[model samples]
Target: MAQATPAKPFLLPAAIAATLVLCGLIAWMIESRAVILREGTEIVLQSEPIDPRDLLRGRYVVLGYPSQRIGGPLLDPLRAEIGEGETIDDATVYVTLRQGPDGYHEPVAVSLAEPDEGLFIRARATRVAHDMTWLFLDFGIGRFYTNEHRAPELERRMREGALTEIVVAVAPDGTAQIKALRQAGETIITEPLY
Candidate 1:
């Protein structure tokens, strides 16, 4: 009978390959977030608590923004460009923001095309009023996760009217990541780039 090649040598190489792939995947995820946090523009946005409880999602705070529902002058140009009978649902929109005196960024204009200059956020139109007067957008920066021990206290403070603000790092493409969370001008929780 021919001697069978040992399985141990093959198994070792396969295990090494699997570990390398897992490490590479983990490294890629960390580097992506780190790039945004390290190189992107930072903006502060006023945040309010929406719903913080979710059994399936674990401990986190759901945030809502005043600029989420946009209307008035901001929608005028966009409406005229698209014309009547055009559907706005699921459309990509770039919302230009200007820093207010209070230091929070506020939406000034919304456009279908990305702004060539200035700080803007890219959002998807979630809903539009039947009259085409207003557009509701989802910015994808709505949740801030925290540890179980701290989640309840943060929720309580927000519910009791504590002013909350989020510091977000916005990439050139308008993708945003939550860099820090603040309550009453004090930094409560910060996200590490690593």
Candidate 2:
């Protein structure tokens, strides 16, 4: 009878390759956020608290920004891009922000093309109004995870009008990550770069 070749050798190499791939993927994710935290421009945004519950992901605070909706001058560029009888939805847009006297960054302009200068956050248009006069945008920085014990207290303070805000780091390309949470201009929790 012919000798059977062993499967152990192939199994060992496959398992090793799989583990290496996983490690590389995890490292890439961590480094991407770290780059933003380390070198990006910092901006503070006024936040509104929403629900704080997730059975699978644990407790986290959901944040809403007044700047989420854009209209008037801010929508002009986007409006000009839409052709007659054409609808725009789920398109990438860059929003230039100017800091108000209150130290909160507000949307100053929105463009289908990335701004050559100015601090802007990249967002995807969730939907364009029928009149093409407004765009609802998602910045993708709306969630802040916290420990179970702290989640409730933070939400309560926000609900009771404690003036909560989020400190975000925005990369040159407009990618952003939450760097810290603030209450009345005081830093509450700082995210680790890892």
Candidate 3:
């Protein structure tokens, strides 16, 4: 059998260029997120407990919001606009939010189209079940990182029913970033946009 030819000499340079491009793209993405967090419209959202776990997230508490699940009377109005025989699962939904007197924003409506105005967030439905009666959506701002020692205290307070809120920054395009974590109206952690 004939011996296989050696790899092309230009292969190494091509590989290096590809790697550099990939790194640049990643840096740009991170910078964009930081910009949104730094200058976007700020809003506080009420949060509920998410299971605490040790993983790659590094001693953080996962958080869930009631707005993540838009159901009950909320589903009725959307059904008419969404029509029938359409799959909402894994679909991108624009959720309109209205700020309350307490400075916490609440979901007011869900739509297939992005709204022209008003405060809103773009989330993907992880699951849509029971004929649209339930929607499990993720806004990609669900985790709050902290030191190992502080996590337990926060978790304990969460267990004791202490108030926890997620301060989010929403950009004009409906992209959102978790800006800080607040417990009992006190900011415990603020994320740096790096």
lDDT of 2 by residue, 70-104 (tens): 98877766667766767768888899999999999
User: Candidate 1: which stretches are off by over 4 Å?
Assistant: 1-22, 54-57
Count clashing residue pairs per candidate.
0, 0, 0
**Model 1 per-residue lDDT tens digits across residues 95-181:** 999999998999999999999999999999999999888899988898878789888887887788785788989999998888988
| Native RMSD of candidate 1 (Å) | 2.6
Q: Model 3: per-residue lDDT, tens digit, 1-194?
A: 89999879999999999999999999999999999999999989988876567677678878888889888777776787778867678888889999988878988888878999999999998998867778889998887788888888878777776847889999998999889888878987788887
Minimum summed lDDT over a 10-residue window in model 1 is located at 48-57
Question: What's the C-alpha lDDT at position 191 in model 3?
Answer: 88
C-alpha TM-scores of all predictions: 0.86, 0.92, 0.84
In order of lDDT, best first, we have 2, 1, 3
Cα error, candidate 3, residue 82 (Å) = 2.4
**Residue 29, candidate 1: C-alpha displacement in angstroms:** 2.5
* Superposed model 3: Cα runs more than 4 Å off: 1-16
lDDT for residue 94 in candidate 1, whole number 0-100: 95
